[model samples]
Target: MSNPGEIAAVIRAVLEALPVDALRAANTAAGESAERIAAATEGTGHDAPREALAHIAEGIERTGEALAGLGEIRERLNAYLAVLVPGVEAMVARPIAGPAGKRPITPPNRRHHLNSVGRKSQVREENTVILPGTDVRGDLDAIRRGEAAWLPDRDRCLVNGRLYGVEVPGTVYPDEGPGLVKLNRSEYKALKGLIEARGDMDSLPSALANNPAVTGADWQRAAEVYEHHKDYRSEDT
Candidate 1:
């Protein structure tokens, strides 16, 4: 993790690099042109300034949109860095454990309930349901068929043999719809690896080190690096 001071400094550099005054100036010019066009139109039916003002407004709107997009990109970048920096720090400080310590972080424990189209009484009353291993085959089929829906608003579910949850919106459920579902701890770790690897493979080591469960001589190397250079920063080019 970056030291708080280093993060602050990077944020300051980002702000300093933004053209706040330029945007303000564009907005001001647009506003002035609009007012002038409005006044000119009051006296004459044909005002050349009206067309100019329209063009100015268009330019201002385009500039505003561009700035908004830049802001969003910057926000997302900052969030990504926040996750990455801490992960890198952890990796550098810790020794690498064998595959045993390499797992995804478990999400917070949340209660999950089943949602049935029929009477609630027909549903299982147990807070936790362990599906039989033999049943896994059929359950997987049912999930493929979209019969069993995972409700994220409620508790997690063991659909088929897999766990699923609706922690984030737009995550496709087994029902072929959008909802969150829980996954087995191992399955979750695998999925996380797939997602993280999509972006950067190098980041994986750091991410693994961040997990508190990671221990042993392997983790010691990461710990040492994190301890020494957690606050290191690079100038933006």
Candidate 2:
């Protein structure tokens, strides 16, 4: 009968203790390698230092991808725990005192690292079906069907829509697109919330762009309007 928040705390603790520690070590190693390469190239005009830097960059990228995959697993585990644990709903519904509830129990640094990984995953997934001059309709259909094998030229698509050229060739679909294509559960939830607020998926991005508070404000307004109309109907009755 663990509370939802308690389950979330446990998940965060488990992730922070192991995966986050490993990720930090990887990041530190990558940083040290980059710094060493930069120092070696301080005076020399040789391409060796540049090549070393490139290798460091690749290692860092790989570490980031690994972290993202781990984070997705952590999230899935947390969701499962919430479903299995009794009294979780009641605990989550009860508000805590002070900023304890406002601030997530998960460490900010760890959360930021996880978010970075999730964002990278999204960019990779979106680019798979969103190449330059791609048949938008067909691509959308492929995405809907969750077909990973249909995409080609995995290296050419934009990363974060900024024209990145780094491409590691192979079957980009790792573990049924876990590391590269599948949307993290939180991402799926956010997308669903946005669509519900905006009336549809097509309108979501625009609504978000035009008003960052679109979902919160619209939901609150909807509740208020419903209550007002309900009161009027009650008076009439």
What is the TM-score of each predicted model, taking all chains together? 0.30, 0.32
Model 1: residue 62 alpha-carbon error in angstroms: 0.5
Candidate 2 Cα outliers beyond 4 Å, as residue runs: 1-17, 88-237
lDDT of 2 by residue, 26-128 (tens): 5545555565567767878888887887776666556655655655676676567557674443122222111222332221122112122322333222221
* Regions more than 4 Å wrong, model 1: 1-12, 87-237
lDDT of each: 0.38, 0.37
The CA lDDT at 75 in model 1 is: 64
Question: Per-residue lDDT for 153-197 in model 1, tens only?
Answer: 333233322344333432322321122232333333322332333
Instruction: Judge candidate 2 at residue 95 and give its lDDT.
Output: 24
